[model samples]
Target: MFSNLAIDVALGLIFIYLLYSLLASIVQELIARLFNARARVLTKGLRRMLEDDDHSGDLGFFGRFTFFNFFYELGWSVVYFFQPFKNSPFLKQFYQSPAIRYLGENSAAARPAYISPAIFSQTMVHLLRGPHKDNQLSDADAIRECLAQNSLQLSADTLAHIRDLFEDARHDITAFRLLLEAWFNETMTRASGWYRKHTQAWLLILGMGIAAAFNVDSIAIARILMKDKSVREQMVQLAMSRQPQYAAITDTLIRKNVLHRDSAFFRTDTTWKVMVRDTSLIGVYGMLRNDLGDAKNVLGISRACVTDTTATGLPVVRCGFTHPYQRNGWLIAAGWAMTALAISLGAPFWFDLLGKVVKFRSAPPPNTTVTGE
Candidate 1:
C-alpha cells in the first residue's frame, strides 16, 4: 500500500491545500482592506457634507456606508421581530420602529434605528429622541400592551403602564417614520456632496477603471467560489471516464489540471484532484467525484467502500474516532498510514477513522452542530 503513487498524491494534495488556503485568506484580506478603505472614503465625504452650513440634507459616502450599515442593521433587527419563527412577535412592529422601540421589546440587545438613503423615504426622526412631544406612555408600556393584545401576559404593573401609554405608541410610530424621511434627505445631500468631491474618481470608474475593477473582482470571486465542495464534486464526475477509481488518490491530478482551470469543460479525458479540510469540530464528510469531466465514475471509492478496494483502485477507506477528517490531499498520508497500520495492526484502525467523518456528514447532526445551519 506504500506506493509511490499514493505518496505523490498525498504530497500534492497537502501542497494544494496549503496553496488554496493561502489564496482564500488573501482574497478575504483584500475584501477587508477594500471595505475599510471604502468605508473611510465614505465617512470623510459625509463629514464634509455635514460640515457645509448651506448643504441640503445629505450624508454623502460616510452617511451611506458607515451610517447606513448601522441603520440597516437596526432595520434588520426589526426583521427578526417580524420573523414568523422568532421568539418575540409583538416586536415585529419595531423592526420598522426606531431603536428605542426595538429595545422596549428586547432591552438587552436593542439600539437606535438609522434612516436608509436608498429611495428617500425617511422624514421623521423626532420619535427617536429621549421623549417625543407625542409621548403618552413609557417604552416598556407600549410593548407590553401590544404583547397582551396577542395573548402574551405580563405582570400587573406592566398591564397598568401599557393602558396609559397608548397615545405615546401612536405618536411614536409617526415620529419614527418622520425621522427616517428627514435623515434620508440629509443623507442624500451628503451623497451628493461626496460625488462632488470625488467626481474624478467616479469618472475614472465609469470609464475604463470600473471595467477593469469588475473583471478583477469577478475573477477573484469566481476563483473563490470554484473552490467550493459542489464544484469539486462536479469536476470528479466529469472526469470519471478516464481516471478510474480516482476518488482518494488523485488530488494532484485534480488541482494541477481540473479545479483552478476548469479543465473538465475543455479536457475530455483526465483525472480530478481535490483537497478536503476539516473546518469544523463536528465531524462531517461529503462525497466528491474524482474526475473533472462527465465520464463514468471511475474512482469507485466511497464511504461504503471502507471494506473493499473501492472503484478508486487501492484500499478501503473509513472515518472513525481517530481519523475524523479525510480529503484528496490527505490521501497520500492516509494511504501510507493505512498500509502500515494494515501491516502492523489491522484494517479496522484505518476504517474507523474514515467511518466517523463519512457517517457524520451523511447523517449530519441536528441544526445546532452544523455551522451556519
Candidate 2:
C-alpha cells in the first residue's frame, strides 16, 4: 500500500511539472517574439548571402526598409505554416518541391504561400536578371554588381562558388538556379539550429522564473505528500479522475491551439475572436483556474506540515515563501533548483512519464490461486 502511494505521489509531481513546462513554453514564445530572435537570425543569413564585405554590420536597414521586412515576414510565415506538418513525411517532401501546395482542388488558382531555398534562389535570380541596362551584363558580373550596389557581403569562398556556378551554367539558368537553392538550404538549416538553441535557453530562464514565482519546492512537497496519508490519497484520487480529462484537453491544445498558428505574431480582431472561441487556449485557462482554486488546500497542507507554535501558543506559518533563501534556506533552495531543472526538461517529458506511471497503475497484478481453496 505504501509502495502504491509512492507511485501516486510521483505521478502527481509529474503532472505538476507538465503544467509548469507548458506555462514556460508559452512564456518563452512571447519572449522570442518580443526579441524577434528568429527574424534577426534569418536577416543575418540573407545579408551574408547577398553582401560583398563580411565586416559590414548594417542590418538596421533590413529592419527599417519595408521591402526587407516583407520578405522576412514571408519567410517566417512559410516556416510557421509548415511547422504543424513537420512530422508528416508526405508534407515534408511536398515542402521541398518547387510547386506550391494548394489549399484544395477547389482553390486551384490560389496557392498557399511559402518560401524555400528554391524560391529564394529564383527570386534573387529574377532580381539580378531584371530588364534594364544591367540586363546586358553577364550573369556573374550582374550578381557581383548587385551585391556591391546593396553593400551586402559574401565570403570569398561563397562568392567564388557562386561565380563558378554562374560561369558553368551561363546558358543553363535552370542548373544555376538549382545550385543556388542547394547553398541557401544548407545556410537556412544552420540558422534554424541557431533559432532552436536560443529558444531552449529562453525556456530555461523562464522555467527558473516560474519555479520561483510558484514556490514549487519539490523536496518539501514530496516530504509532505509522503507523510500525509489523507492528502496523498486525495491527490491520488484527483489525479486518477482527472488524468483522462487532462489527456483529452492536452491533445486538443496541441492539435488545435498551440500548433495551428504562429503564436508570435499578432492577429486581427476577427481571427483572434475565432481562435478564442475554438482553440484549447480556453481549456488551458480553465485548468489553470482550477489549479489556482486548489492552491489554498495545497497551502493548508504545507502549513500543517511546517507550522510551529510560539511561546504565546499562536501558530506561525513557516513553509511557503516565494523566495527559497529564507528559513530552511539551503534545503528550500535545493527544492527550487530541482523544480527548475524538471521544468527545463519540458512538458512532453513529464507527460510521457505520467503516461507510463498511469499505465503501470492500470495493469493487473499477477494471477495467483490459493491451493487451500
Candidate 3:
C-alpha cells in the first residue's frame, strides 16, 4: 500500500514540474526573441573570432557588478542595432556586405540569427581580395597583400594566423576559403555551447521565479497527493490528458482533438461547431485567460487562495498576506529550490520521465504462486 501510494505521489509531482518547465521554456523563448539573443551571441562570437579583440568578451569594471549584467546584454542588442553604420571595422564591413546584408531584414536593428560558414568564408575572401584586375594580383596574392598592410584592422596574431592558413592552402584562393570555413565552423561550435549555457541559466532563474510566484511547493503537493486519493487520481488524469501532446505518429486531426481549441470550441459541444467568434482585438485577451486557467489547473496552486461568491452574486477573492506561503517560508523556499532544479532538467526530461512513471504506476503487480517446489 505504501509503495503504491508513493508511485501515485511521484506521478502527481512529476506532472506539475513538467507543466512549469514547459512554461519556463516558453517564457525563455519569448525573451530570446525580444532581445534577439541568438544574433547578439553570434555577433559577439564573430567579433572575437575575426577581430581578435578580447575586450569584447567582458563589459569592463561594470561587468563585475551582478546588477548591471542585464544592462550589458541589452547593450549587445544596441550594438547589433548600430552595427551597420560602424563600418570603420572589418567586422562591420563584413556584416554590411551585399551577401551578408541581405541575410537580415533591411531595418538597421534586424540581425540574422544564423550565417552559414561557407558564406562567411566567401565574404571574407571577396572583401580582402578587393577589386584588383585579373592581370594585376591574383585573388590569393591580393588577400595576402591586404593582410600584410593590415588594412582590414586585423590584430597582429589574427593576421599571422590567416597568413599561416593561406600558406597551408598553398596560396590557392579556393583552398584558402575552405580552410577559413572549417575554422569558422569550429569556432561556431563553441559559440553554440555558450548560447546553450546562457539559455540554461535563464531557465533556472525563470523556473524559480515561476515556482515561487505560483506557490508550487513540490513537498507540500507530494504530501497532499499521498494523503488524498482523489487529488492523486485527478493529477494522474491530468497527466494522461497531456500525454497525447508527445504522440509521434498521431494524425493532425487527432492531435487537435487531444488539445483544447478555445476559439473554435467556445460554448460549443461539438468540435465542428463554433458559438462565439473572437476578433483580432480580443484574441490576446482570450489567450491570456486560457493560459491563466491552464496554470491554475496544472500547477494545483489555485487551492491556496479561495474565491467565494457573495450573497449579492459577486465573487470575493483573497490573496497575498493571507496565502499559505507567508506561513511556511522555509518550506516554500526549499520547495522552490527543488522545483527549480527539476525545471532546469528541461521539459523533455520530465516528459519522458512522466511517461515511464505512469506506465510503472499502471502496471499490474507480479503474481506470487507457491507450488510444490
Per-residue lDDT of model 3, residues 181-295, tens digit only: 8888777777777776777788899989987887777776776677667767777776666666543312221222211111111111212222112242144234434544664
lDDT of 3 at 39: 69
Residue 210 lDDT in model 2? Answer: 72
> Worst ten-residue run, lDDT, model 1?
280-289
lDDT scores in order: 0.31, 0.57, 0.66
TM-score against truth, every candidate: 0.18, 0.61, 0.72
- Native-referenced Cα lDDT, model 1: 0.31
Q: How would you order the candidates by lDDT, starting with the best?
A: 3, 2, 1
Best-fitting candidate, scored by lDDT: 3
Write one digit per residue (lDDT tens) for candidate 2, span 63-118.
77767766775665466444523323322333333343332122322322224565
Give the RMSD in angstroms, all C-alphas superposed, for model 3: 9.9
Winner on lDDT (1 vs 3):
3
The superposed Cα distance between candidate 3 and the true structure at residue 155, in angstroms, equals 1.2
* CA lDDT, candidate 2, residue 143: 67
Q: Considering TM-score, where higher is better, how would the candidates rank from best to worst?
A: 3, 2, 1
Q: Please list the residue runs of candidate 3 whose C-alpha ends up more than 4 Å from where it truly belongs after superposition.
A: 1-3, 56-88, 106-109, 247-300, 303-326, 362-373
Off by over 4 Å in 1: 1-3, 36-136, 142-373
